[model samples]
Target: MGITIKDIAKAAGVSYSTVSKALNDSPLVKKETKQKILRVADEMGYQPNIAAKKLVSNESRTIGVVWPTVERVALTTLAAKINAALEQQKYHMLLSINPTKTAVDLFNRFQVDGVLVFGEEAHEEIISSSIPLLYYGEPGPATYPTIDVNRRKAIQLGVRHLVQLGHSRIAYIGDLNPQHSNQREKATGYTLGMEEAGYSHLHEAVDSRGLSWQAGYQAVKQLLSKKKPTALISASYDLTVGIIRGIKELHLTIPQDISLVSYDHIPEMEKLDVPVTAVGTPVQTIATEITNHLLQLASGKKVPPAILDVELFQRQSSRSPE
Candidate 1:
């Protein structure tokens, strides 16, 4: 049978109520006594029942993370980092892949201290909840803080990098869905960057069906045969992988024949046949930002919206067109 708090109290020679206070690290208990009680509880292998503890403290010490698209590599890494950060603070993280509304309802019922949703778009009928919610996208009137990354500036950095390499014609690869604000923002940045480079007519936009390598391959293939640009900028790490595949299939070499840049800091994206230049905030930076916001909300503090900017990285996949 598993050890119980009563057994721990008896072994430590403390009252059951005092054991409880010690386990909770209540200030009412003496530090030395609390340490001794905790050591005895640990030695007895007594695990505190979180459900019972929550009933008394009214804090679950759990944060809910809502991420519908588990396929995003960057987001997956970032989520893991954020979870680690929360764990360091003695808070547990709960992940939910349900739709926005369902996920919100689930967290609300679970009564997590706060919720972090990692996307810009929400469901058509998102239920309002009393739980403190923070979104990693555009700010909404949903009575919670929102954190956003400047995706448009990220793409513009990529385009500007290519332009400085003496590439006049450039193509952008991203989802053309107007509903996807993130993708649209990147495309907008590409257009603006092209105009700034005095090549407005040379700017090309290719729509990937989804943010995957397959989508990138097909989109780039179609564009390669129709209106090939001097350089290509992919909107996501997966899409960039696909673009590299498409380039190889077309018997083209990176930089020597075509320059390539992608919108992520994925290490795999840099280990390709021709290392890719990139333009986006590092995943660690984004993860740290998100963790800070979640911790703030957990402590009953107001958190304002955040939109982190992107930076460019030059690599072997790109060179001056001269």
Candidate 2:
């Protein structure tokens, strides 16, 4: 017993075609007539059947976000950023936390205009999907377009910056799993930067094992117990929060005791007890780029893979070793 366009047309004393044009805001319908029709439609409690609408227009005007989990802090922030950008383009963003393959299948069933995948781990196992896809991390299966920050360059530059400040004993703390491509790139950057600076013997990389805040805090505590590094570079914002906690618990102060540099650019870094020096593309910049790529793929356009460079933002957390 749901209200239909015919009912609205009859109630508004107009033909069915005229009612349809007014409801869709077609330019052929006068503004006042459209407004009156809209009012009548609202009063009649008519809800749109999205599936039917999609069948007619061939576009859902929705973008599905396939995120592995909502537990990751950085992922949530980036999702919000992408959502805002999509809204501006009159596209709705929907999120799914299902496994990569499952999420893709679900989005396909829903018939979203496009799918944006966040890379947390290697997705080589994902099967080919017919829908347009744009990845925000490493390129996965199906040869879709991918855009990522240059993680290796970001970490390498962090190490070089610390070395230039006369700190030979700079340690890097992050995930050391070989299967995680992004973290491996960072680990490699730390080693390469050390070798390039002639400080390979003094280089130490602590394994965080996971990306949790607790992992960062415990990694640093164990690292401090065995080695004495004048400077430490923690990878990821969550880990940096834990690193600072571990340092403070030991009655040490940043710069005066141990200088630090983190490997992510976010506003939260500045709000910490000691504002952090960071290296990477700003979150806003990455978000905007990914949004644009997602829209392009949705329109059946191809975008070549992109690797964004990094920049260092010096702050209160790092200084010369005195």
Candidate 3:
């Protein structure tokens, strides 16, 4: 279907072996012949077969990313950042949105230099493979290398920021399923943060039931109808969007009627109708850390488990109760 070495040989009027030697720049081929064959190959737009090159060099210079869930917008930024970071190191990235095992198997079949799994849920497991694998998100296997963000601490920081602004009555909105480990971490942080602030009696939470924008919007509308908190912390970016929409529909204003803080510190937060105060290590920093560890893994260098810290970024969406 595409240009092939055989086609280039015919165009150059050379024997198959002669074309092969010239293409490889073999010393047996005369310099003029090699150049002529190379020129012909270039004219024909011949492209090297990755599989064939792997047989000779044993390195594909490719990284496969396993992204089982495609609906998560917050992670899109992180994935793109990682892609750019990998390109800086002369590595190409491939993404698979299939199930964990199937994606890993495909990457293994392709013989990519490594695999990075973008884990979303808790209690994740993978089949043992000869290829190096790394996880980002919730805890994976004990022996598996991972890049974990301190999500619980991220929420705690959000709570701390609101409490410092003199808001004792605060609420949290997010998925509360005990089985969902990522959401569980944020929920725990809210509890611990309230207790640490000595406002355990004022602690409140509304389960969004899901992480979608619609879920957040509905959850906030329901929560606000029953009770009014001076401030609210959201568990996700998508939920933050829904929360803002819900607040506006209720004729309430951010930081005037209610203040808000969100979980993800992504660029989109700034572009929202009301800029959001967010919690987490910036995706750029997370991206760089992930890229460095991936390179290390590809080089056969063992990487220790990493847990990145999250911090609060104060912005227009959160302030002292008015």
Once superposed on the true structure, which residue ranges of model 1 sit more than 4 Å away at CA? Answer: 1-4, 10-14, 21-46, 120-122
Q: Output the better candidate (1/2) by lDDT.
A: 2
Kindly list the per-residue Cα lDDT of model 3 for residues 1-322, writing each as its tens digit. Answer: 7877888888989987898899877999999989999998988889877777689889888899998566777888889999999999978999999888888899999999999987777645556768888988866677779897899999999999999999999999999998888789999999999999999998899999989899999999999989989999999999999999999999999878999999998998999999999999999999999999988998889999899988888889999888
List candidate 3 stretches off by more than 4 Å: 4-47, 123-126
Ranking by TM-score: 2, 1, 3
List model 2 lDDT by residue over 243-289, tens digit each.
99999999999989999999888887899999999998988889899
Task: State residue 288's C-alpha deviation in candidate 1, in Å.
Answer: 1.3
- Best-fitting candidate, measured by TM-score? 2
Enumerate clash totals for all models, in the order shown: 0, 0, 0
Better-scoring candidate (lDDT), 1 or 3:
3
For each candidate, give its TM-score against the true structure: 0.89, 0.92, 0.88
Compared with the true structure, what per-residue lDDT tens digits does model 1 show for residues 1-322?
Answer: 5777889889999898899899878999999999999999888778777666689888888899888687777677778888888888888899999987788899998989889887746345655878888888644456677787788998888888888888988899998888877778888999999988899988789889789889999999999999868899999888988899998999988988889999887566667878888888887788789888888887889987788977888889989874
For candidate 3, the lDDT comes to 0.90
Of 1 and 2, the candidate ahead on TM-score is: 2
